[model samples]
Target: MTAGPDPVAPGRTTTSSASTGELFGAVTRDLSTLIRQEIELAKAEATQSARNAGRGVGMFGGAGVAVHLALIFVSLALWWALGDPVGLGWSGVIVAVLWAIVAAVLALRGRTELRRVQGLPRTADTVKKIPHALQGHEEENS
Candidate 1:
């Protein structure tokens, strides 16, 4: 009698046929793409946040500079108006130092916020599904 087609032949190509390696590769590619997209999204968000932070810091710095200059003017005016009762130089120096401290605090806070936006957790979460997806694909293909 003629032999019928073998079911488990290694090179057989059934409708559901795929090698473990191929399935793994496909799943890997898909997961890599997903991770890449997620990373890109995170990077874009981080960049936007950085831009916003930069703008905010710039504005804060500018306002602080303006306030310092204003304080200098006010101190000078007060010194002149009070007939130099209190020295304007000391008041200007104190206001300038206070403004510097405030600016430094704001910059540190911004740096902390940016650091918290790192993308590793999101990438790990997405990568965690890759093995399961590959296993399922392997079973279906088998």
Candidate 2:
């Protein structure tokens, strides 16, 4: 008697499926896409950090202009007031020194804000794990 067709196993695909090369190609494509997405994420993070850095630099520029204007107007008033007690030249020097202190404080504040900016923390963290994942050591690295 002829036997019936072999029964297909449960939870398994037919042997007529894709070849090994085709499966490898699919994995390669997926991996390439993942790498590209990671690169895009890194670019976005860099852009955000650059904007924050720009803001810090802008604060420095604003401080310089503000100090220059204050020196021109407010320093004259201060110098004139001190001119009575001290000579005009010494009073001018005192006003100039005060303005210098104000400029220094403004510059320090801008530097502090710049230091607060963090660059690519998340991106760097994830990138470090990519090699481990590709090597099939993801669990160990994690």
Candidate 3:
């Protein structure tokens, strides 16, 4: 008797004969690869955005320092004008008191705003569901 064609032979082309489970597995693997690629793309985009933002922030920091120096000169001029009425020492003391009050108000507001921030809750929730998705429970709720 002649031997029949072996399905298990090497270099066989799988066509319509592939089972449903095999198709499903292939789809699952493809989907996993696509997801990983998407994740890498997102990471690259985020890094570029962060670098751009860092450069912008550095420029802003330079501008802030320049403005601070200008403000210092303006404060000195104010102190000199105020000195015409009061003594020079009292004018300097008045400028110091005004700056101290402004500093206190800013510190209080910054602390309040910082306290109100909550960290990445939506991202945490999505990350938590990943294990369930891997276990094929992705459509369970739907």
Q: Which candidate is the best by TM-score?
A: 2
With a 3 Å backbone cut-off (N, CA, C), the pairs that clash in candidate 3 are none
lDDT of 1 by residue, 38-127 (tens): 678667766776777777668867987888787777756655655555466765566567668977997898788667644455555545
Off by over 4 Å in 1: 1-15, 83-142
RMSD of each candidate relative to the true structure: 7.7, 5.7, 6.8
Instruction: State the TM-score for model 3.
Output: 0.54
| Candidate 3 local lDDT, 1-142, one digit each (tens) | 4333346764433655656886688778867885686566556666766676667567656876888898899889989999999989999999999989977996786567556444444444455556667677865432
Full ranking by lDDT: 2, 3, 1
Instruction: List TM-score per model, in order.
Output: 0.51, 0.75, 0.54
**Model 2 stretches with alpha carbons more than 4 Å out:** 1-18, 63-67, 137-142
Question: How much is 49 displaced in model 2, in angstroms?
Answer: 1.4
Worst 10 residues of 3 by lDDT: 116-125
The total of clashing pairs for model 2 equals 0
Q: Residue 34 deviation, candidate 3, in Å?
A: 6.4
Ranked by TM-score, top first:
2, 3, 1
- Cα-based lDDT for every prediction: 0.65, 0.80, 0.70
